[model samples]
Target: MLRTTLVAAMLLATTPAFAQPEPARVEVNGMHMYYEVSGEGPPLIVLHGAYMNIETMGAIIPALAESHTVYALELQGHGRTTDIDRPITYQNLADDVAGFMEAVGIGKASVFGYSMGANAGLQMVIRHPEKVDRAVLASVAYDAKGWQPEFLAFLPQLAPEFFVGTPVEDEYRRLAANPEGFPALVDKLIALEHEPLAWEADVAKIETPILIVQGDADTPSPEHAVAMLRLLGGGTMGDMGAPLPASRLAILPGTSHTALMNQPELLKALIGPFLRGETPKGMFD
Candidate 1:
């Protein structure tokens, strides 16, 4: 019923000269994945950040749907997707995304990932390069250690109950009940760490075109974005030296972690042309 409603909404919106609708719910590895597909060009898969659902990408969807077949997924334990029985890890999440693509009959698709989803996107590209044609890593970090300090300082004050095994939804509700609980939620997220991947080594293996987008105010610093670009841009090394793929890094002015939601024009300015295979003019280039 949910799938039907979304598809009907999309069709109604598209018929009067909007984008075309291509909606369905696909089951992969015993998990039901909800996705809304639109438009009719090259496939583009969108992955949202941690603690966010597919709806979080709503702000940027319409623009991308203009020219590409956009597939926005709700990661495990987010939105309508059921939680995994085992503890979640980046690799597991990446595999789930890859399985989803295969189940949907997508041979190769461009991936767009935001925040935690961006990290997962990197894992997918590294672990299953053949499935990805291109990628966009938005507000991502290559290292988890660099993020610990900020998370430590903020956790204790927010939702202490999360430490006692509260479900994610309950924790969110508790935080919502007391706005001050937000910090604790961040701490819990930071505390739940995954084994770090040797990003430099893994990035060197990526041969697909990539676009790295970061906001001026993204946490842990803008230097992270620069690091990603250098790693993926081949740096001083030539083509033979662990050669990086074709990529571009765009740092939007006065933006933050939620740049896609808050700055649609800028988001479109960077992504629209890139999906179309046209070079983004000026700063985006």
Candidate 2:
């Protein structure tokens, strides 16, 4: 998937404005997984947030593709991937991601996920460490308590109509393999959100370099974001002559979880180099 710089540019030239690379399907975990492959260089699997699909990451992919082979997957029940009768959980989705990577013959790659996708990204590192070299978790927390009470309280009250005027509803209607399944997907997610999260120990055990990004005013307060980072070896002063921690944290100013995709440039600045095996400019330093 490593392409010369000129080749990367050519791919862009051929891609129309606001369109992603054409998607390909694979069988993973008994589901027909849909993924879009683009860009050139090391592989980077980009996971979209719950209730969204590849298009959610559309604004960010073109730039990211300039330097990496981007594998954007639509998880089970989201986008073109069909849902099963099983309960929706990050652990199951993480397994599907692992199977998808294997199906596509990608042995190892950096993974990035936002919001619910962020939850999955962290799980990928914990559940399938061999397949991920680094991970980026944005707008999420590893524990249920990591979320603000207001946000937690509002989960069960969400209805599909609540997103009617937004792109979330529009896209779900547009790209979901089973358009009618959107409502079901929403309910499942609401239920999942209320369940206790158990990622602190898993995250603490992850040795893969990670970048934790969040919007200052987004889900889980900045304080909780820092707490998660601490568990992942970030947000701490280093001992004299000690090795620098592999994890980094960033809190985007004036950002919201729902608004993350719009600020592609800032996200690219914070994460681009880190995926390339380079130290990202420390946002917290």
Candidate 3:
């Protein structure tokens, strides 16, 4: 059961409610990155998880597009973007996103990132704070220890062949500029999984308002999520009269990493108000 669930979580694919619009290309960090923009309002950058593209973000794109101009990106070798020689790391991906925004004329925007994208968004918040307003980080872990032990144990066994008949492979073959490089991409991502990822110290220094969204059964353990909230100055007793923390945490019941992406309605409800800076008024308030 753990292996099966981990496989699905690694793929992170979801059926799109609608076909993606034509993507535009921009020269970013020595690669021609692909991105699509939709709807209108405040600028919001939406990033996909590992082995995922803009289409795999599922209904969340449309859900967010209704309230914000959604800039859905294909990072590095994923989706329509071709492989570059540099290793796939959170820092590199974050740098590419920052450069992409600069090349495309967006000065600053809110970011909503999931899984691998979430890690990159954390880097952006830490390494390039001036370019982000607010951020929504979904299914992320600050360090290797934050991952559930079972999930961490399963990472070493990952191989491209395991995904051959899955939607992940199908989409890669359909959209990757260099389709035959899928195996190489998987290898790079595998190395990425093994890379050191301790960022709790950096996270403690972040000043940008962020929402940490996790599934009850996510790869990052629930306790780790709460620890992250504390690092972000969250986990406060709001009704006790103290000021609310700049960050917030949401754990969806009965959801896994993959399942979390499918909960577009719930995500929209949490994300819209966060980005708009709308605080809900309660009777106690």
TM-score of each: 0.75, 0.86, 0.93
| Cα lDDT of model 1 by residue, 1-285, tens digit | 011112223222221222444556778767677677876689999887665555445557767777788898877655556554444556777899999988989999999887768888988998999999888887766764334365435534544353343343443343242434444434434444434444777876677778888777665367766777777763343444343336777888886454434565678788866665674244323
Candidate 1: segments with Cα more than 4 A from true spot: 1-23, 145-152, 155-194, 234-245, 280-285
- The collision pairs in model 1 are 158-184, 159-184
The sequence of per-residue lDDT tens digits that candidate 2 reaches over residues 211-262 is 8888787776888888877887777676544556788888888865555556
The residue-by-residue lDDT of candidate 3 on 236-279, one tens digit each, is 77777766887989999999777888889999999888898877
Regions of model 3 farther than 4 Å from truth: 1-13, 19-22, 164-166
Candidate with best lDDT: 3
Model 1: how far residue 137 lies from native, Å? 0.9
Q: Against the unseen true structure, what C-alpha lDDT does each candidate score?
A: 0.64, 0.75, 0.85
In terms of lDDT, model 3 sits at 0.85
